[model samples]
Target: MKKNFKLLMLAVFVAAASCSFTTKSFEDPDKDKLLIDLITYVLEKGHYDAKQFDDSFSEAVYKDFINNVDPIKRYFLASDIAEFEQYKTSIDDQLLAKELDFFNLVYSRLDQRIKEAQTYYPEILDKPFDFSVSEEINVDYENLPYASNKKELKDRWRKQLKYTTLSTYYDNIEDNLFKIENEEDYTPKTKAQLEADARETTLNSFNDNYSFVNDLERNDYFAVFLNSVVTQFDPHTNYFAPPDRDRFDLQMSGRLEGIGARLQKQSDYIKVVEVISGGPAWRGEHIEVGDVILKVRQEDETDPTSIVGMRVDDAVKLIKGPKGTQVTLTIKRVDGTIEEETITRDVVEIGETYAKSAIIEKEDRKFGLINLPAFYFTMQDYEERNAAADVKKEILELKQQGMEGLVLDLRNNGGGSLRTAVDIAGLFIKEGPVVQVASNGKRKEVLSDRDSEIVWDGPLVILVNDASASASEILAAAMQDYKRAVIIGSKQTYGKGTVQNLLDLNQWLRNNDMGDMGALKLTTQKYYRVNGGSTQLEGVKSDVVMPGRYAYLDIGEKEYDNPLPYDKITPANYSPYDGYIDYESTIKRSNERMAKSAELKLIEENAKWIKQRQDENVVSLNLEAYTQAIKDREQYAKRFDVLEDYQSGLNFKSLPKELGLIEIDSTLGQNRQRWHKNLRSDIYVEEAVSVLEDLKLNNIRQGSLAKIKD
Candidate 1:
C-alpha cells in the first residue's frame, strides 16, 4: 500500500529542488507558497492520473475550498463570497505562478469573520429561547445561500443555537419530570431553570467550537487549502500535516503507548468513543464509551490541566505518552457521576485492529472464524509481525483445533497494506496472480502469490460489507475470481481500487530549513482483480448478496466527485481453483435461504427505515412537535429491536491459545465475549457459516490444476 519515493520521480525533482529551494535567502519567505510549488510538482510527475490544472480544476478547488472552510454558510457573508468569486477560475493560473493572493485574501477574511462570529455567539446565548415559537431552521445548508448581511447572519446564529438547545431542554424537562414521578421526595426544577441549563449546554458547545478553531494556526488552514487542491484529482489523495501524518502512522501500526481510549471532542468534553481491547483503559474497566474526560494530569504534575473546550488532538497529546508512564483522567461517567482514575500507559496492541479468531462450534463441528480488521503491516519492516503473518498463524492454530471450514470476516475493514492482501490470497490459493496494479502509461504489474503453500485448503467463506475497501476488495475479488471462497454480506464492497504511496515532502528538498514539510498520500496506481476488472467505481459483488444498512448509502467510491473510472485490462494468466465441487450450487443454496430468512427481511426493513429517516432532513423547532416526533420514532423503532435480539443459536468459542490468554487477561475475555454475543445476533455471519458448511471441496490437489503461465 506504501512505496518508497520512485527513483524516476525523485530524479525529476532533485535538480530543480536543489537549485531553486536549497537557498534559505528569498525575496519572500513564505512556506505556504513553497509547499504549493512542491506539491504541484509531485502531482504532475508522480500521480497515477494527473488532472489538468485548467479552469474546470480551478473552479472545483474554489468551491471545495469555500466548503471546507465554512461548510454551513455560517461564516463569510454574501459580500465576502462575491469579493472572492473573481479568483474562482484563476486559481489554476495562480498555482502555476506560485501566487498566494487568493489564499491570503480568503484566510484573512475567514480569520476576521471567525473573530466576529465568536462575539455573536455569547451575545445570542445571553437570551433565553422560547420553545413555544413554531419556527424551523432548515439544516440543508449546502442548498441554502450565505447570509445577506450582518443582521441576517446574527438571526441565522440565533435560529441555529435555538435548534441545538431545544433537544437538551426537552431532555432536561423529561429527566426532571421522571425523577419527580419516581422518587418520593424529589423536587423538580422550574421550566425556566431547565431552559437556562439547556442554553448553558448550547453556550458551552459554541465556546468549544470557537476554542478549537482559535487553536488553529496558519499552517493548519493551509493544510486544508492544500487538500482542497490535491483532492481535486481524487478523494484518496490528501495532504497530511506533520501531526496528521503521525496519527495516520499510529493508526496503521495498531500499536501505541497510551491509555488506549479513542477520544472525540463532544461539546466542551472529550468523550471516549472506544476503549481499545487489551489496552490500559479496557483493563482499567472505569473509562468507557460515552464517558466524558473533564481533565488530564501527568504523573509528576501538581494540578490537572482542565481539557474542557480543548481540541481533540491537543487532548490526545496530553493523554498519550511513552510506555510505563502514568496519566490520571477525571471522567464524567455516562450516569452523570464524577470519578478520577489513574492509569499506567503501556505498549497497547489494539486487538480490534488485528486479526483475531473465534472457533464456531456447531453440532460437534469446529469452524474457524478469523475477523481481520485491516491488512496492516510495519511501515519500516515488512518482515515484522503483520496481518498476513498473524492470520496464517490463526489459520494454522484453528486447524490444530479440529477446524473443518473457515469464515474470514472483513466487515468494516477499511484496508491497509496491499502486500498483506496478496499474501493473504496466497494462503487460499497456490502460486497465482492476486491483483493487477497499473500506473498511467505503464504496463500492468501482476502482483502474484509466489509461495506455493496453501495454508487452508478447506471450505472458505469471506464476509464483507460496504466498509470493506481497497485491500479487502482485492483479497475478496481474487478469491471470488478463483472460486476459492464464497463471498457473502453486502451487495458489494466499498469500491476503492487506487493504491497510494505516502510521500514525505521533506525528502524532495535538499539542505532546506522550512521545518517539517509534512507528507502527501498520493495515488500512484490503480489495482484490478485478477480477472482484469477494476473495482474503482464498481466494487466486487458478493456471491450470496445479503441486505446491509449501507446497501442504500452513498458511501462508495462511485459517489465521490472525481473518482477514477472503472475499466478492464487483459486478465492475468491464472486458472480458477478446482478445489470446490459445487461452488455455484452452494451459492444458489445460500441465496435461496437468504431470500426466505425472517431475520434478513427485518434487516432489509431496518435498512429502508434508516434510508427513510436519512431523507427526512427537515426538523421541527417547536418543543411539543419535536417531542412528539421523537416519541413516534421511538415507538416505530421498537419493532426493529427484534432483529438485534434474534439469536442464530450458534456457539462461538476461542481457540486453545486464546483460551489460556483469557484466563490471565480478563479484558481480552470480555472483548471476545462481547464479540461472540454480537456474532450470535449477526445474520450475515450465520449465513457465512452456513455457506461454509454447504461448500464441499473437490480435493483436486494444488499442483494438478492447469495454470497458464505468463
Candidate 2:
C-alpha cells in the first residue's frame, strides 16, 4: 500500500505543475495587449525588470497571479473597482508611480507590523490565547445593505481591527523571538519571571480584543487577511523568517540530525514531546517527553549556552545538524532533575507517524485493523494512479488471510485529497452516495461510489478521536449514516468537514508580472453526511466513546480560528445497509469491559499526568529540580505500558508465528507485526467482533440462525 501510494503521489505533483502552466486565453479584453501593457509596466517599475525576469519568471509570477486573483475579470470589492478606475486607459502610469510604491509600502508596513507584534509574542508564550470568554457573534446581513453605512458594521470593524492587530502582533513576536537565559546576569529578572510577564501581556491584549469584537464577519475578514498574506508565497516558503522551519520539519518528519527527540513549545520553554521510536534519545532512555531543555552546547564548546524560553523551532536548529555531528543538551526532566547528555546525530525515521494495521482476536473470532497515521500522500504519486485502490487491495488480502472483521483507525488523521477519501469509503459499501457538498446554496454535489463491488461485508468498525478530521470524518460519518459500521473512540471527531481549493497566485496574476506571489488555498465547500448533518465544529459523535489522552486538550475543529458555523441541509435519498447487525448490546458489553480493565484505567489516569506536565512550566535555577521533573514523568509513564500483552492466552509466540506464515524478508515481517499491533488497539475492530458474535449468539437463542452449508 505504501509503495503504491508513494508512486501515485509523485504523479499528482507532476500533473499539478503541468496543469498550472498550460495557458488558456481570457474571455474579457485583449489578452495580448493586456499582457504587453502589464509586462511593460512591470519592466519599468519592478525592482527586477524585464532583463532580470525571464520568460519562466514572467509566466510563473505574473500570469499565475492573475489567473488566481482575477480569474473572472470582475471586481468583487469597491477597493478593486476603484483601483481599476485609475488604470482604465493604461496601467503603466499607476504601476510605475503608485502601485510599486503601494507594494513597497505594504511590505514595509508588514515588516514593521511583524516587529511590533513580536514585542508582545513572549506574552503568548507566557500565556496562550484564551478563548474561554468567546461568545457567538452573529451578523445581520439582511438589514445591513451597505456594510460601510451600518453603525454596527463600524463598531464590528473597530473591535475586529483591534483583535487583528493584537493577533498579528502576537504571531510576529512569537515567530521571530527566541528565549535564552543570561546565566551570568541573573540578578533581576529570572527566566520564569520574564515568561510570566510575557504571558500576562498576551492575556491582557487577548482580553481587550475579545471584549470588543461582536461580529463574526469582521473577525473572519481579519483572519482571512492574515492567512492570505502568509499564503502569498510558495506553500512551504512561509513569512516566518526565523530558523524554526527546520525545527518544524524535524517534528513533522519525526527525525532530526542531532538529538533524536521531539520537542514542543510549552509556555516559554522548549520541552521534549517524545523520544523518536529508535532514535538516539530513545536509545539513551534519558530524554523523554515533558523534559525541559534548559541549555545546549556543541561537544567541544566550553560554555553551555542557556536556551530557556527560546522558540522551539530556533532551539531545534541549534540542536540538529549533519549526521555524525555531536551536541550536548542540558535537560530538566519531569521530576525536576537536570542532566546533560551528549549525543551524535544519525538518520532517524518517525515510524509512528505512518499507516499501520493489526488483528484483534477474542474467543474464536479475529478482526483486522488498519490505523492511518495521516491522510498523507506525496503529490506526484497520487495523480499518476489512485492510492486508495492499493489500500483496497491490501484489505482484500487481509480478508483472504482469515480476517472476519475490519477496524479502520483514523486517529490524528488530518485529511488529504477529497478524491482519495471518496474512493476509500467506496471500498466498503456498494455504489451509492457517500457525502453531499453544499456551496453558494445553488450548487449541491453528491459524491457517490460509482464502483459496483463491495470489498468487505462482515462487521466493520471505525475508530476516531478528537484529532480525526476532514477526510477521516467524512469516511466515518458516511459509514455511520449508512448503518454499515459502528463508530468508536472519542465523544466526537474533529469537525473539519469543509473543502478547500488550492489556487495558484502566479497563474491568477499572469498578465501583471508580479513574480511568484505563491498560492491561496481557499475554503470552497462544506461536506455533509448522507443524513444531512454537517461536521463543522460539532464533529461526528461516536456510538461508543472511549477515553483518550487528549481529552483535556482543546483539539479538533472547534480550536481553529474563525471556523465556519455548522448547519444542516435537506436529507438526500440513499439505500440503507441490508441486515445491519444491531450492536447496542455489544457496545454496552465492551464499555463494561473497558471500565473494568486496569490497563484502560491507566490510560484514564494519563490525563492527570498530562496536566501536571503542562502546569510545571517554570524552570529552576538549580539543576536538581529539573532532573527530578524528568524522573517524575518517567516514573508516572512507567506505571502503565503503551502496549499491552494481548497474547497472554493466545497460541503464538511471535507475531509472524501467530499469522502462521513468514514473509520473504525481515522488513516485511516487521511491517506485518507493526500492522498487527496497530490493528489490535483498534477499539472499532473490538466492537465489530463483539457485534458479530452477539449477532450470531442472538440468532441461535431466538432459533433464527441460518446455517451456510458447505
Candidate 3:
C-alpha cells in the first residue's frame, strides 16, 4: 500500500479502471457540467478512501481552485474572494446538481481581472526602482493578506516588480564590475543605463510569463479546476487531462520519437535547454544548450514557421514526429550565428533512466555498485528492460568479475513497479515474505520471495536518502527488517507508503457520447513492511544515519500536504536472517565511527546553515544591504568548499558489458569516469564502503548454507 505509489502512479500500463457509469450527458447542455458529474461519480465509487462529496469537500475544492488560478494573488482582489464565498460551500450543491453558475461567474471575473492586471506590470516597470529606500520585501505570499482594492493591488504589484528589478539590478552591477576588472579596455555602463537594462529584463520576464498565462485555453483552465477538485481528496489523487496524460506517458517511458532536445520558452524565444545525450541532436552535434530555436520546417513544407511566442507544448508538437522523419530547425546559437540543421527523428531513449553499474577497487578488494534509478519495467513487455532483470544480469556480471561486496544505491530512486521491487529483493535473499499489501475490503496479501536461491551471498549495503520513496522504501524496509543489508545514508527514506492506480474515466460510461474522459489516479491501497511498521510518515530508518543536504530540510512524505498518517500492522510471520557475523555489533561499530567522523559533522552543520538560509525569506531592497547579503552568502559558501575536496581513493571502472557501449559513445565512458570521480568524492559512499568493510572483516556465519526456512 504505502510502498507501491510510484509503480501504481505509472498509469500507462494500467488498463481502464473498471467496466463501470452514466454513458451520455442528456440534458446538461454543457460539457464541463457533464464532466463534473462523470468525475464526481468515479471519485465516489472508485477511490479507495473516498471523501464524501458534501459541503466540506466543496469548501476544500473552492480554496484549492481559487488559489491555483491566482496563486500569487496578482489578479483577484479581496472583493473577488468575498464574491466567490457565496458559492464556496455551495460547490458541493453545484457538483450535485451539475450546475456551472458558480464556476462561470468566478471564471468571467478572473478573466476580466487578468486583462486588467496585465496593464499594471508595464506601468510599474516603466520607471526605475529606487533601491536606496530602506524597505524590505516579504515573499512569503501564503501568510500575507490579499489586496482590498485596485489601489492596494497596484501597490502590491509595484512592490513585487521592484523586488524583481532590484535583484536583476544587483546582478547587472556585479557583471559590469567583473567586466571592468577583467577586460583591459572595457567601458563600464553608467548606473542609470544598467538600471534601465535591469528594468527591461524584468519587463521581458513578466511579459513572457503573462503571455504563457494568456495563451491558456478555457479547457486548460478547466483542467486546473478539475485537478483542484480531485487533489483535495488526497495529494496523490489527480485528474490528468488528455495532453497531461500523454505527457505523463512520455515522461514515464523516457522514450519519445523526436529530434531529442528539451525546449524552454524564454522571453518569446524557444530555447534548447538540453540535447538528449543519445538523441538525433547529440548525434548531429550541431545543436547545443543555450541555442534558441527560431523557426521549424517540416520535410513536407517549403517554408519554415517562426515559433517565437509559441507555447512550449505547441512548439514541441510541431518539432516531434515519428521516427525516420526529417525536421529542419533554424537555431540561433549562443555565439549569435543562425544555422539550418536538419535532424532525422529517431526513438530517443533516455539512458540515465535505466539501471547502471560500476565496480570500485580499494586496497585490492573489488566492490560492485548497482544504481537503480527506478523500479522500471517495459509496459509492452514484462521481460524487456525491467529493473529486476537488469539488476540480476548486472549482479551476475559483477559476480563473474570476482566482486567481494555489493552496494545497491537507491538514493533519489522514487520507485516504479512494485512487482519489480519484490523481484529485485528476491535476488539477494533466499526466500521469505518481501512485503504485505492491503486495500479496502481485501485480506493482507503477502508478496513473498518464493525462490530459495541466494544470488549475492556476500557483504551487502543499501544506500538511501530522503528522495528514495515508494518501492525504494519497500526494499529498504524489507532489508532492514530481515537484517540482510546494512542500510545507510539519510535518517530515513521518503515515507510514501500508499499506492495509486489510474482509472480511465471513459471506461466508466456505457453508451458513451462524450469524448475520451482522461483518467483518475486514486490511492487504491496501502502497504506495510514485513515487520508490521508502516513506512508512511516515518520512513525506513537507516542503520547508519548519514547527514546530507536534505538532512535539515522539511522534506519527504511527512512534509507533504495531506499525506496519510503513519501506523503499524500485524508483523508478517517470518524469522529474521542471521546469516552474517555480528550484524548487530557491526551496525554499532559503524555508528561509533560516524559519531566522531569530521566529514559527517561538517555535512550536518552545512545542512543546518542551508535550512537557516532557506528560512530567511525577507529581502533587503537597499543596494548596500543586498550587496552585503551576497557577500555574506559568498563568504559562508567558501567555508564549505572544502567538503568537495575530501575524497576516498577508490578506483571506479565501467563493467565489461558497458565497455562496448563506451566504445561506441565515448560520452558514456566519460560519464562513467565522471560518476566514478564523484563517487570517490562522495562522503556518503565512503561511509557505506567503510561499513561494508567492517561487516566483511568481522563476520561469523550463523548458518552453514544460505537457504530459506520452511
Top candidate, metric TM-score? 3
Name the 10 consecutive residues with the lowest summed lDDT in model 1. 1-10
- Over the stretch 400-502, how does candidate 2's per-residue lDDT look in tens digits? 6677667777877877667777888888776788899876444689999998666766677788888888888988899888877778788898888777654
> If both were scored by lDDT, which would come out higher, candidate 1 or candidate 2?
1
Query: Which regions of candidate 3 are displaced past 4 Å?
Result: 1-29, 266-271, 284-310, 321-344, 510-514, 663-670, 697-710
Model 1 clashing residue pairs (backbone): none
Candidate 3 lDDT, tens digit per residue, 420-440? 889999987778999998886
Residue pairs clashing in model 3 are 1-526, 1-527, 2-497, 2-498, 2-527, 21-508, 581-700
Candidate 1 lDDT over 209-281, as tens digits, reads 5555665656566677888899998889998877678767777878778998888776667999988877888
Deviation (Å) of 606 in candidate 1: 1.8
Given candidate 2, what's the lDDT at residue 28?
Answer: 22
Better of 2 and 3 by lDDT: 3
Winning model by lDDT: 1
RMSD of 2: 16.5
All candidates' TM-scores?
0.87, 0.51, 0.89
Segments in model 1 whose C-alpha atoms lie over 4 Å from true places: 1-29, 257-346, 699-710
